[model samples]
Target chain A: MEVYHLYSGGKDSSLAAYILRKIGYEVKLVTINFGVLDSWKYAKETAEILGFPHEVVFLDREILEKAADMCIKDGHPTNAIQFIHEKALEEVAKLEGVERISDGTRRDDRVPLLDQRKTRSLEDRFNVQYIRPLLGLGYKTIRELTERLFIVEVKESEKLEKSDYEVELRHLLRERGIDPLTIFPKKHLQSRVIGWKKEKAHL
Target chain B: MEVYHLYSGGKDSSLAAYILRKIGYEVKLVTINFGVLDSWKYAKETAEILGFPHEVVFLDREILEKAADMCIKDGHPTNAIQFIHEKALEEVAKLEGVERISDGTRRDDRVPLLDQRKTRSLEDRFNVQYIRPLLGLGYKTIRELTERLFIVEVKESEKLEKSDYEVELRHLLRERGIDPLTIFPKKHLQSRVIGWKKEKAHL
Candidate 1:
């Protein structure tokens, strides 16, 4: 009854972990690291704040490089981010004792999204349950829940420091003398769950 | 926050109510009664065993009649059941102080299924959140979770005395001199959650 949730140190994934635990699953927050930077540490810190055991799974560095190339070629990050996400899920699915894997992808998410067909295929191949607790909840409901349950810090996507795949992808572009801002979209605000509203912890 | 879950005394909806409560929502199980039969009482009893408040919302008898007519004409119960399910949700959505509504429709449900567009429309029109916690879980995962968490009785569809919409629909057809077996598919097994597995209740 343990589910390894893909953690990004953000409100949505944090909430997914919370809901999974509430519904009787032991949640282990996992951040996939690809050697691009120590980004997973940020997620580890947030996981500690949320009071869940945290782990860093090492994905092939080549995968991040390929995603970076795709981002640079398309000047958009959607496809590349989605690529990394699927790879991360596959890695988790292959882990021992990991019969259930989950992510925070919501109904309104455009990037890093797994459609039902892909989800089913993963479940069938790995004999694991791929749970997306937020898939049925829309933007309005998610915002309302997070506002009540989490202490979040919102900043421009470029300035925000978190363990989501985007952080490493952006760094890869920078290493290759490319400004991530050019390939990555502008004016996007990202949120990081710094802590919980302690009063609502028991609820 | 409180959610009015469409309860049928079946494992799916019962689990939905349990999950909603575990996630910090006060759940009130609402069984929509069209007065075709007193089937809602069955759901009320199960809700009592699960330790949640229960209420019966009466819908227009005309709606059930219309669904029965559809069943007789088509010689199949799919469209008829879907019609009644939609009507039931509408009745719940229109209730005063009902800001959130939920159902047990799972990933593989065909009849009475609400596609994203239809769900969004209901939410927009009613100004309420339509929650479906089981929509992302496929048959295997759901069966596993229910077996672990609930004490359920499995019986042939016709013999199962539960509060699901199909029960009332069958009664309506029978009242109109139809065998109900002629229009409803056979050999389908239905489940009723008689109680929770006491040892796993808190989890």
Candidate 2:
């Protein structure tokens, strides 16, 4: 079975892709470029290093603006990020032979989360399986897995250019003379997968 | 208002007592000695160093045995620790002029947690307020506060003789020819508050 995985080149997404491949499922890495500066660069590099087929889907710039506007209106980025995530999933589900869509949503991830109702609706509407392989795992487990599987570079979320949709949304809001801090919490941490190393064969 | 705090001479309890004092409450430190070896020794030293009036209550050795037995039967220590905690609170609430009881439970503490129903029942039955000053704070916040307020010595829970209820329960179970690892999960990290140096007065 081939799974369309939402790839951001971050630790969670890369680990999710690796898990799928290890379990004998073909993975198609899809990165959505929402007109953010230097966003898809890391994803391309990571896919090459991991030796997986990758695709970059260009999204309309207005979609990011809409999400940022929602963040500004609500005084929080939760609803905005969820909107962008659902939009990415909707776009990925349209690809041919893509019956299963997967992402790196973890148990502790608050934003960009598809709740039970949203998950059910997406599966029913698209007639596809929406899977989150890391959903049962927490941040500690994800970090351990990433460390064991790949060489990673971790930094504050604000410092990472090639991150999740929130980064692009923050940049867009700032360009429009809005303070991103007003819509986002401070001091969040994120990771980037730089490369991979072969481990001892245990099987 | 006078509040009776359950003091274990650990990081969480010491920080909890300090927070209550900073917020202008007359705090009374109460340590329960359940016949565990060296359990009340650190609590005595910590209370003297912090310049708080402290009381040590002697609990029957059977209490620790009961909790240990519960752990052995259930294959976990969560229920056993909670039972001991409630019993300690009930005993402290009977003290003269003690209208409120508190502990150092932080947001990240999974064990020794009193669910909402149990908390409400304790308050209603005893007609005393049950408070956890560090309830809203996470582990990082608690550690930061402890660092700012006092010099601390930290060790693993298993390494320290003066620790939480689980330590004594494990000892009791082991003495009775039962392996504690069969009941308690491994590699759990807990800290003991050993010795403190006075910081510059900020108030």
Candidate 3:
């Protein structure tokens, strides 16, 4: 069975591919790179290091323009680009009866969807299998797996550029104590007030 | 130092608390039970077994119902309910001054934000440290740890309701010989095209 992993060449995706390969499956790596970034910064390089066939789906100006339009028209969140990647996955899923397109998203991410929401019914439509090898995994094991495999470490080249949103947000929310996961748009606050003061506070 | 673990009562979460206690931290267990789901199915039972203070935040009918409505109205696939759970964590973050909110979401869950879709900023806003003890850990190790602690086995649980849409779609799509994660509500196909088509195909 041929499986395509949504590769990103980072600790998570790299570890995910390692585990899938170890489980005795012919795996191919695929990464949807945004034009602004190195696109294949980590994903392609790692796929090369692992000696696996890799595909890079470049997000051209048209793709970015459409994304910006979606965000503006639908009031999509600033990070709604995942939906685009999901769309790219569909293009890949149509490969010669390819049955499954896998990803590295693990159980530990605990991240919310773009627009501060979660994808509900997007899956049934795609008509492909999204396998997350690390769904039930923990961070500690992934680190150990990386260490064991001697997969290329998170080198300067593999890391996200300073402009990468993941890197930017990680710094803001994680290091700066912003807690983006809990913060929401104006509308979210007007509704259910969790621990907020009735009027003065914004979520 | 005060720390809170997002407990789902799953073995992974159970081990998180167990490991933390072993290391000796004043740990508080917070369980989020979306009202739409069987909130305390295995989680509550698991928490009872371990003797940890379990605080469950239910997504009131108002919350999830409204979220489902927004999804339909906007033609966007989203789960606002999960955001509420994140919001609840912020409350916990504030109440306990918990510098960190650790979860069972592992390393593969690197897609903390939608690739190009949206962003979750709550984790940053609250200054709450979000830690995934298992981020580097694997499922096999998790199973081993559960057994080592004499916790309930995975085999005992007949059904585990998931929180992520991609995983749920994976199951449904796999059942129908497709990959759900691919069509992750990308603009290529509207909900009518994907959701109804899959539903029709299923029947």
Candidate 4:
């Protein structure tokens, strides 16, 4: 079976894709482009580094604007990001031949996490299975696994360029003269996979 | 890193150990023996067939008796089984050098499932990480994966010889002149891993 995994150029999603492949699924890395910025290209490049087939799926720019507006009105990005995340999943789940969809949501993730009800609804409506490979793993284990499994670059969220809703949302916020730093929390770290370690140590 | 997985010779736990090994953890299969029966031997044989090292961890027989009483009082095995599952996790979490522990819990499991708060509490109290690789997967995906991944034997729960707590619990109930059939629901199916599929087709 083939599973389409929502890809960001980040450690969590990359690790998720890795696990799915190990579990006998042919994994396709998908980067959603909402047209606010070309962040999907970053994800595509990272996917190339990881050696998985990759593609960009374009969503309406209107959703990005709406999510940004919600952020401005609510003074936070939690609900808005979650909104876009669900929209992204729905879009991918509807594709022909896409019977299994996945994301990198983790046990410790607060924002952009799909509740069980919504997950079941998505699966039932689309006749698909939504797999979150990292859902059972918390932050500490994820850190250890990624550190051992890949070479990564970590920096503040805004400075690090990865394919996630935040990049486009931040761009839209900047376009509206709203500083994203004020909306997003301070000192938030983001990571991008650079390459795998040379040792093949796990073998 | 080494992770001790709570194994029962069932497909779910076997698949969990497979995924953990793929993620670079040396997996040790631990079968809980509650002294009601020698069911751990079944799990040991399954682990050998899968080529993983296995061990039997003895838990207090008193706990099993208490859980059996809970079942008789509640007229159902749900609460009692959950009680024993948590105790088993606690006992395994205290073993030497066990920094990570895992189980075969799935997203749809109701009874004997650990909630987020309790999972966090276990991690904090024991200073260990709890990993449930199958927790993100539902019934359909698990069935698909297991069917393709292993050679399995299926039978009614009462007739199956897996190493789950139900076997010993049922034995104890019958010893007291109670028909375990009255306590456990009817037509419940159980599975045991007999061996791997030939051809190593996935490779």
Best by DockQ: 4
lDDT of 3 by residue, A83-124 (tens): 555555666666666656666665445332211112212334
lDDT of all the models against the reference?
0.88, 0.74, 0.48, 0.90
Q: What are the per-model C-alpha RMSD values against the true structure?
A: 1.6, 17.0, 17.8, 1.4
Residue runs of model 2 more than 4 Å from their true location after superposition: A36-38, A197-203, B1-203
A best-first ranking of the candidates according to their DockQ comes to 4, 1, 3, 2
Which pairs of residues collide in model 2? Answer: none
Between candidates 2 and 4, name the one with more favorable DockQ.
4
TM-score of each: 0.96, 0.49, 0.37, 0.97
Q: Name model 1 segments beyond 4 Å from true.
A: A199-203, B199-203
Best by TM-score: 4
Shift of residue A167 alpha carbon in model 3, Å: 9.3
CAPRI grade, predicted model 2:
incorrect
Scanning candidate 4 chain B in windows of ten residues, the lowest lDDT window is B194-203
Q: Write the per-residue lDDT of candidate 2 for residues B1-203, one digit (tens) a residue.
A: 67889988787888777756654458888888777665777787887777778888777788889998889889988889888988888888877777788888655567677765677677777777776755534344455557756767666566765645776778898899998888877776666665554553212
Candidate closer to the true structure by lDDT (higher is better), 2 or 3: 2
* Candidate 2, residue B169: lDDT: 79
Candidate 1 docks at the CAPRI level of: medium
In terms of lDDT, model 1 sits at 0.88
**How far in Å is the alpha carbon of B198 misplaced in model 2?**
68
- DockQ numbers for every candidate? 0.65, 0.02, 0.03, 0.82
Task: Report the candidate with higher DockQ, 1 versus 3.
Answer: 1
